[model samples]
Target: TRMRPLMRGGAQERGRRAGTENVPGIAGFGAAALEARSNLEARTAHFLQLRSRLEDGLDEIENVKIIAREAPRAPHISSFIVKGVRAESLALNLDLKGFAVGTGSACASGALEPSHVLGAMGYSASEAKSALRVSFGVQNTEAEVDEFLAALREMTNRNGTLSGRSTSHFTL
Candidate 1:
């Protein structure tokens, strides 16, 4: 059996990964994971507090629905729907303002596919496409969420279209 190994090459990662093992990348990931684990309790508390504040701010906006409002959610992530606007458009508009957001399953990012999870949970295709995912890290602050809400509100005003695309139209 010439091809005993998966790739017929040296076991870069003990026959696990085929490509060369990225030491730096792996190290960085491990460091971040350890840091997150070490601060899990405090970070969870902070994220929960921030999520409440953000949800409250979102409530002040019109035509928006907080997904799973009655369901459980991870403290670090939020998914919502901005009625009458495409999630991609809204996400892009916010990203241009120096904010990062996810429009669908993070693993399928840039694929323009509606989330299977949302679809399976009974959201129509159109509604699923309008879903947006926002994640928070320990470095974030409540004030930042307030600012983000302001930008999002302006971007998806009652007109159902993004406001002026210029930096002047949004305050990050």
Candidate 2:
């Protein structure tokens, strides 16, 4: 696995990355990693709080369903489907509103096909079509989440009403 690749010295990294030695990047990454490890508990709590707020907001809106709600998820990510809206359109509208978001999967952004992740999880074509992903970073705050929710509500409501239709629901 890439995350647990054979332990190698700096020289091996240099060879693989094709750089003499990115001392600064390595040092910075190491520091960030340490900080992340140390702050894991607090960071996780904050993320869960924000995620809960986002989910609550989405619940009040019509035709929005939280995908993988019962599944174990990372602290910083939220994926959902907004009925009657396409993921691409939602992403574009959010971008225009100065909020960065992802649709389907990053790798499948430009493709017309539905997300493989959703398909693998048994979402139908229309359900997958309405997918959107929001990943929060350390810099994100409650105010930012509120703002995003407002923007999403406006965009989705203005577009059309959400249809609560699910072709299939299954766990993978």
> Model 2: runs farther than 4 Å from truth?
1-28, 158-172
- Clash count, one per candidate: 0, 0
Q: Which stretches of candidate 1 lie over 4 Å from their true place?
A: 1-35, 165-172
Please give the lDDT score for candidate 2. 0.74
Per-model C-alpha lDDT, please?
0.76, 0.74
Tell me, what's the RMSD of every candidate?
5.0, 7.9
Candidate 1, run of 10 with poorest lDDT: 163-172
lDDT per residue for candidate 1 within 1-172, as digits (tens), equals: 4334556466676664577767999999999999979988998999888888888888888877888877887888777887777888887778877787877555556666777878777887888777778888878888899889988887876755567764311111
- TM-scores, each model vs. reference: 0.74, 0.75
Candidate 1 clash figure, as a count: 0
State the lDDT of candidate 2 residue by residue for 10-32, as single tens digits.
Answer: 55553344335678999999999
Q: Number of the top candidate by lDDT?
A: 1
